[model samples]
Target: MAKIEMKNPIAELDGDEMTRVLWAVIKEKLLEPFVDLKTEYYDLGLKSRDDSDDKITYAAAEAIKRLHVGVKCATITSNEARVKEYNLKQLTRSPNGIIREELDGTVFRAPIFVNNIQCCVTSWKKPIVLGRHAYGDVYKNCEIKVPGAGKAELVFTAEDGTEIRKTIQMMKGPGILQGIHNMDKSIESFARCCFNYALDQKISVWLGTKDTISKTYDGNFKTIFQKIFDEEFKAKFDAAGIEYFYTLIDDCVARIMKHEGGILWACKNYDGDVMSDMIASACGSLAMMTSVLVSPDGNFEYEASHGTVQKHYYRYLKGEKTSTNPVATIFAWTGALAKRGELDGTPELVDFAKKLEKATLDVIEEGTMTGDLARLANPPAKQVLDSWAFIDAIAAKLK
Candidate 1:
């Protein structure tokens, strides 16, 4: 049989380390036989990034913007150590964070549920997708430390020639003051991204904020989300059989811990920053989580939530046996391909993604897993295969 052709090819973002190794295998084992895939590859590896002065990340993101689908690998976030190790010219930052900021998207991380792994929140039968707002709150902040007695105030002057100033506090002794800002445009972008994602997925959306406490900072989020929901999505929610709810931050966190799944949690930058890590731990291993950047315009970028697996990469370099789990990386491809299929009206590739995802999960359910799960085993499951072999197990089933 001739290989199937997909018109909606992905703008592939290749990265470093173990994921770099797995990228090739995923194409060969999962994608090649299924689809005659076309990829606009950007070498976002450490060396290439240094050589390109990280222009490649922006170019890659722009490519995604143009093409509407991206499948990215986990790249090395060059630290001082990495700089010495790679023996490079200039220090490079993390490609993932840069691409995300440039694309102006929200990251939605969903755990890859497999029967073999035990979820800390056991009730999460379905996926609980978190559309984390990545723009403001603690990430961008103005700070001042009072050496002497001083007043901390927030001043807002209206366009109608009315100046409003509020002095929140007067420092008794040496203290700290802060001013954080989020542009209306940024907040609107976040709202659109979450609304677009929830509507696209047909999943309920929930927004949480500590509006009761920090009325100004958190209230901005609440007001924007409400405005967007009411103006754009109310009737659509009714039509689509999905719901939207707003709750206090504390309540949201508590509910998230207790509730099962099938709800989308839209959080502010800081909340997402904290909760995502918590959720990652709760779901078991970071390796099991998959992060996807959903642009406001509905472009997609999928990658492993975990890092480059630096330790495993070094061992693999020494030609040692390494069972670096490739499930998340595999899902990244499946997601991009599936999104491509959906956009292009190609049911074959869409079905291929679903089946490939199921195959990976099925392999896990059968207890044929890599080192991470093997270590996290409840009764310590005996059978353990290395990385390539485990991927082969998934591929054998995919075939």
Candidate 2:
């Protein structure tokens, strides 16, 4: 078959660990074989970030903005242990966080359902999409260690030299003080993204926040979402036969447990981070979900919701084969390709992407999968394969 032609290039950001190993194999086996691959590649591995002082990360984000689409491999967010392991100069910030902030995007995650793997939550019959605010809050925070009893104050100074101050705490002992903030413009962007995505997916939107406690902070979010919905999206939502509502974060958790899925639960940064993982695990393995960051201005960044398989990577280094799931990563590629095709008006490329996704899920539904999914397979997986073997199985089907 003649390789599918591409009208545009995608920004491909590579990363670390077991997923990084699988990234090359996936491209070689599944993508390059069928499509005339065109990409602006950037290495986002920890070492590269350390070498460039994370300039590579900023460049990758810029590429996505220029190209309007990107596909990323799972990356490492170095802690003290990882800092030592990689022998890094400094503990760099999360690449994903930086990218999200740079792009000013909102992450939407949903489970990839297959008949063989049953949802752990029996009540969840459909997919619950998680719309995560991708900017501000704790992702960008400043902190200080309080070595002794002292007073901590929150102060703000204007450009004109006007100042406002509030006492945050009167520390009676050694403790920690942290300050996190969100911009009104970013919040407005987040609100519009959720509403627009819900309209696109034809699903209801549920926003969860703690307005009762963090009145000024969380209340601002509630107020903005309502204002945007009423001012811009209410008529459209009514026409689409969907609804939008807000509830306390705690109440939202309870509601998620009992409600039959199919709603877009828009959450604050931290809430979405925690809840998306819960949703992913409840549906199946973390590798069974798809994540895409959609900016208000129409840029798209596709990536797996899960992190790099660090333990599995360690085992692989010791010459031990590990059965790691690659479904989410595969979907990340497919999602980017499909979106690229859609934007470029290349239907053949879009069709190829669809076929590739079908091939992946079909293999899983046929009882041949990696250990993570094999354990959850309802009729019991007939054959459990290692990482490479699993991709080979899907490649065979793709061919």
> Highest lDDT, which number?
2
Candidate 1 wrongly placed segments (more than 4 Å): 88-91, 136-180, 239-241, 376-382
Error of 2 at 373 (Å): 1.1
> What value does the lDDT take at residue 86 in candidate 2?
92
Quality of model 1 by C-alpha lDDT: 0.83
Write one digit per residue (lDDT tens) for candidate 2, span 231-252. Answer: 9999999999999999999999
TM-score of 2: 0.99
| Candidate no. 1 TM-score | 0.86
- RMSD after Cα superposition, model 2: 0.7
Candidate 1 on 161-264: residue-level lDDT in tens?
89889997987889888877777777888888888778888999989999999897789889999998899989999999999999998999888877878888
Clashes per model (N, Cα, C within 3 A): 0, 0
lDDT of 1 at 147: 93
